[model samples]
Target: MKRFLGFIEKEFYHIFRDKRSLFILFGMPIAQILLFGFAITNEINNVEIAILDHSKDATTGEIINKISASKYFSINQFIEQEADIEAAFKKGKIKAVLNFENDFSKNLVKEKQATIQVITDATDPNTANTISNYINSILQNYQLDQNKDIKIVYQIVPQTRMIYNPELKSVFMFVPGVMTIILMLVSAMMTSISITREKELGTMEILLVSPLKPFQVIIGKVVPYIFLSMINAVVIILLSIFIFKMPVQGSLFLLGLESVLFIITSLTLGILISTISATQQTAMMISLMGLMLPVILLSGFIFPISSMPAPLQIISHFIPAKWFIIILKGIMLKGVGISLLWKETLILLAMTLFFIGLSIKKYKIRLE
Candidate 1:
């Protein structure tokens, strides 16, 4: 018991003595939350749109007025010629261009309708779609107001309810993913590098020749990291719950259990990495470049899998971080139970077992 406490105290010194890493470990979650909350949002507000009104009549003027009055569109430019529209977009000034057809009032009175073209830059598709929808909503509202006195035979009203995120807040999607990535980095990457450091320093040989079993040595090394990562997870959850006002609708106990499972899975990966890497530098590099990038890009963390190419989407299935993040979101945001997240939980367990099995095999080979 004394020896274990001393070992834990040594681990604490190793962790706290490093000022830079300590700062990163504690500071990163707060920084990431702020960045994702304020900066990287999907919601569009006051998007700049240009107007190209070929018609100078009442109908076109009214439509333009309605668009300009709405909060979504800020009409920065009124292009006289069609040529200017391309130049404005080339300069990256405007996202959309609303063009009213020639003789809009005449067509509306004579033909009972006027044509308006919405030209959007598809380079950033989400923003483009939002701008287009905003314009459509303004027009539809104006039409409804104008036709309130007249009777229509049938009206098709489309009702929408956002299932996962009612407010369409990207933070709701990001908090779980960010939490997963942070835990993975701190537990897996840091532990891997630290273990490799022991090997590089000739300390592993001394530990191996000691009375402690190989598995026990590895467990002792990783146990402190597991506790640290649990602290990180708790801190992140508290920030998300209190600061962001995000809810954990599912069982808190279940969330903690799943988190521990994921931490163990990540620790197994760290062990595998340590077994493969001969040096601390190599371990760190492998963890950052190989694990972190794939976890971020392919894990459906920032971008939706549905939006990716078929090949990348297929590749994402193998990333354990992907499954863990999905489970976190299911439990945290959607308040889903074990019934919904069982598949992801099973996949994580399988990954953990696979990594541990591979590491054991590799370690035995090294021993022989």
Candidate 2:
């Protein structure tokens, strides 16, 4: 017990002594959370647009007024000639161009129908689709008001139930992803680099020659990381709850348990990396470039798996972060219990076993 405490104390010194790494470990979670929460979101607002109204009537004027009044769009430019449309788009001032057909009011009154062409830049498909949808919604509302006296034959109202995140809070989606990233950095990157540092400095050889068993030395090194990762998880959860007003829909105990499991899995991976790499730099590079990118891009963290190409979607299944995210979403948003998440939990367990087995095999090979 005394030896274990001393080892733990040494680990704390290593963590606290380096201000830069400590700052990165603690600061990155908040920074990433804020960045993803505010900056990278599916919702589009205040999109700049251009208007080309050939109608020059009450209907076209009202349509323009309606669009400009809404929060989603701002009428940045009004093009006179048809040729200006391409120029404005090329300059990138407008994302979409709303054009009212000639004699819109006259046609709507006499023919009981009107046509408006919404030309959108398809380079950014998501933004373009959102802009078009917003415009259509505004027009539909206007048409509903104008036709208040007339009865419509077909009334199709979309019953949209935004599952997982009912309120469409981008923060909800980010919480799990942020937590995973923090755990990955803290457990995998930090442990692997710290272990490799000892190897680089020749302290690892001394330890291996000491009375401490190989597993004991590795466990002593990893225990502090496990504790630190858990602390980070707590910090992130508290920040989400208090700072961002994110609710804990499921049991806190379950969340903590799953976090611990993921931390262990990450630490095992770190152990494997440390055994394979001779220097801290290599460990850090591998952890960041190899593991981090896949977690962020392929784990359904930043992009939806369903929308991805078929091959990519199949490949995403192998990412451990994907399972972790699924477990998190089920617990945090859907408020599901072990019954729903047992399969994911089992998969994580299997992955942890696989990583630990591989690390042990690699370590044995090194010893021989």
Candidate 3:
């Protein structure tokens, strides 16, 4: 019994002394609980929406006021005409647009009913559905409150039009997110584990001492993985189109180019991980824990970023997967070209450059 107690005490001391073990035991749970609690939410707050009021009447004004008063929505803009709605959605700022039909108040009073067309950008079908439901609820509550004393009960009908995805297919949303995750995790894990394996087996020192330069070494290490990742991407896209009937509304050439760029960005990030990590296990752990979680939770893949807390939303901007997912959705669903997608494309390019520079610097330090 005494020897067994000594062994248990030694195990406790070993766990406490290792910083990584301490973090895995205590820090990870705390961080995961906080991230899951805040990020995994169905309710949306301060979602940006626009209004197109043709009536310009008291009834429309009151309804707009009521919508603006709620914390669920923030009136981003008041659109002028019907043609502007498409442009607004392509710009990727407005989620839903409330278009009040002409002669709203007069029709309500004369015909005892009125119709409000709810046009939603349904690239993210869940959010579109939720926005439509919230608006309908508001209209119902308003109708009930106004008709309490009247003999003829007034009705406000919401005709919801889900553009881009009328059927609200879950596959439309999942494909882009899954593709982003696969590219990021696979590319990163492949390169990170490859380089770290060389280090673990003592072959990296042989390569370092060779005539090849560090940049050349890095490029050679990543080139094979880059080709493999592109093939994986093409296979995924083909499967999505052929098996699932997913449409590629935009240019395929442009999609291929953007995918190559994201793959490079992910590979460069992996190289950075390899430089800092001493073993394949550490690199794999970092790739899974550091990259996978952010890609799933913070990339607006599973949940709306506008619905997350302010800090998480801000942190999401740094995530490359977030921008790639946006780009994929824009091309696949909206048929948006390079003009509308330039900003996100540029962001991914900049991240690629930043990661490349940092990885090279780290590699040079390790060489020294």
Q: Which candidate tops lDDT?
A: 3
Worst 10 residues of 3 by lDDT: 19-28
The residue-by-residue lDDT of candidate 1 on 60-158, one tens digit each, is 787788777866668879999788875666444466788777877777666667777787754334455566677777777877887788764222122
For model 2 the local lDDT of residue 79 reads 86
lDDT of 3 by residue, 56-155 (tens): 9999999999999999999999999999999999989899999999999999999999999999988888999999999999999899999999999898
Higher-lDDT candidate of 1 and 2: 2
RMSD of 3: 1.9
Question: How displaced is residue 248 in candidate 3, in Å?
Answer: 0.9
Quote model 2's TM-score: 0.60
- Candidate 2 minimal-lDDT segment of 10 residues: 153-162
Top-down lDDT ranking: 3, 2, 1
What is the alpha-carbon lDDT of model 1 when measured against the actual structure?
Answer: 0.76
Which lDDT tens digits does candidate 2 get at residues 1-368?
A: 99999999999998798665654577656654643444345665667888888889987898799889987788988888688876666443467787777777787877777777777754334455666777888888988887777764222122222223334467877888989998988899999998899989988879988999988999999999999999999999999899977777788999999989999999998898898877787688678866787788778687645444456667778888989987776676656678778888898899899999999998899877
RMSD, model 1, all Cα superposed? Answer: 14.8
| lDDT by candidate, in order shown | 0.76, 0.77, 0.92
> Given candidate 1, what's the lDDT at residue 152?
42
